[model samples]
Target: MIRPATPNDAPAAIQLLFLAMEDIARKISGTNDMQVVTHIFEHLFREPGNQYSFENTLLYDAGNGVAGMIVGYDGGKLHQLRKPVLDYIRWQTGAGVCPEDETQAGEFYLDSIAVAPGNQGKGIGGQLIDAAVARAAGEGMRKAGLLVSTDNPAAQRLYERMGFKVEYTMPFAGGRYHHLIKKIDNA
Candidate 1:
């Protein structure tokens, strides 16, 4: 069962999100401190307008609890909610990290997707990707995009199989990432 994430899902969603983007999180926070990162994530995930807010997340539930999650947002509106989130991160981490140039304009940006460690290989990740794309199309977006680390060949392959083509390579989160985009067919 895939559903929109609720405030109550913050803990679970944060866990998976941190698991998936630990390196990126650390880069932004300027600390490898798990506690600080977790604190920042908790605040961000519970807040209303930020990129990682519950409003922008979806959870895959497999009976017991949240088994997976996908976080994304409209690229055009990406900066509208930036100040508050950045303020919160700075307050919590004492590091003012600027947003990376990750998504192209007018696209739906898939920020992060992760299944619980034990839940991988069960198709939850793919389902979440499909759901994210469908959500983008439903919102009238013309394309969907995401970044895959250059070293993460498995994920890059998955995106390729889903019809995403690498549009360019961008430096992000202390490493190079392939920015992939897929046209969203509304029909």
Candidate 2:
């Protein structure tokens, strides 16, 4: 079943977030220590309005644990949503980042998504994307967008299969990325 994530999902969700984040997690944490990154993000995850908060997350719970997650929000709110995270990073790591805009007006951005390694090949990812799409449509979004690393062809193929088309290529998080979008409304 898919449901909005909550504080209780932090531990599991952070692991999944870190898995999806990969190198970005290290950048955000300002360190390569897995424990420190997890600790920092888990703290942010439990908060309510930040970009990494539970307010922006949904997960698949298969009666036992969180198998996957989709974290996203309105592109127009990117700055508002990211402020808390930036503040938290400064407070916790004493460092800062000037992340390039990976999203913009007129879409609901899918910030991150990952399925637990144990749950791979189970079709859970598609279901999660479907859920996010439905939510975006219900919220009156014109489109849904996400950034995929250009080097990750397999992931790009999955997004293509799900109706996303490359709108452009740009630099983000220290690599080239394809910014893909799929219309979610008639407009």
Candidate 3:
């Protein structure tokens, strides 16, 4: 059952996100940096007016845990290609980097879609995507997009099966990343 996330669900949401990120890191770089991952997750809940939103849906396990998550937002103005280059070198020269050809206007970003490890292979991911699509349509968004790490083939396959196409691929942070876009009718 998908429902809106409230402020109380912040801890569970962060846990689900961490699980998903661990899976991604293991699949991509073959490393599990829990410290950095935890910091990022903590920062999201700590920061005020963060870019990402988690009120769309939060998958309950029906027992005592969260099985997955589907997070998206009206990311029409968040995609800037030169954000990394300028924000990094100018401010923090040795800071972390992201995809170089960032987002452009009119793109609603599907920031993250993750399912728990134990609950995977059971069509939960598909359901999350469907929920996100429905929400995007309801919000009258123009196009939905996301950045998938090129090393994560499982996620890439899942996104492709859900009508997301690879608009372009580029190198970033010593690795490859794919910018996937899905055009949806905002009518």
Most lDDT-accurate candidate: 2
Q: How many Å off is the CA of 60 in candidate 1?
A: 0.3
Which stretches of candidate 2 lie above 4 Å from their native place?
none
The better candidate by lDDT, 2 or 3, is 2
Cα-lDDT of candidate 3: 0.62
Evaluate all candidate structures by whole-model CA lDDT and list the values in order. Answer: 0.88, 0.90, 0.62
The per-residue C-alpha lDDT of model 1 at residue 39 equals 84
The ten-residue window of minimal lDDT in model 1 covers: 77-86
lDDT of 3 by residue, 55-118 (tens): 4344545356678786676665454322432343235223433434346566666666777778
Tens digits of per-residue lDDT, candidate 1, 1-187, equal 9999998888899999987898778877778898988888888888898888999999999999999999989988777756677788788778858758787578999999999989999999999999999999998899999999999999999999989999999988678999999999882
lDDT of 2: 0.90
Who is ahead in TM-score, 2 or 3?
A: 2
Judge candidate 1 at residue 94 and give its lDDT. Answer: 82
The total of clashing pairs for model 2 equals: 0
Backbone clash numbers for all candidates listed: 0, 0, 2
Model 3 reaches what TM-score against the true structure? 0.71
**What TM-score would every model get versus the actual structure?**
0.96, 0.97, 0.71
**RMSDs, each prediction?**
1.2, 1.1, 5.1
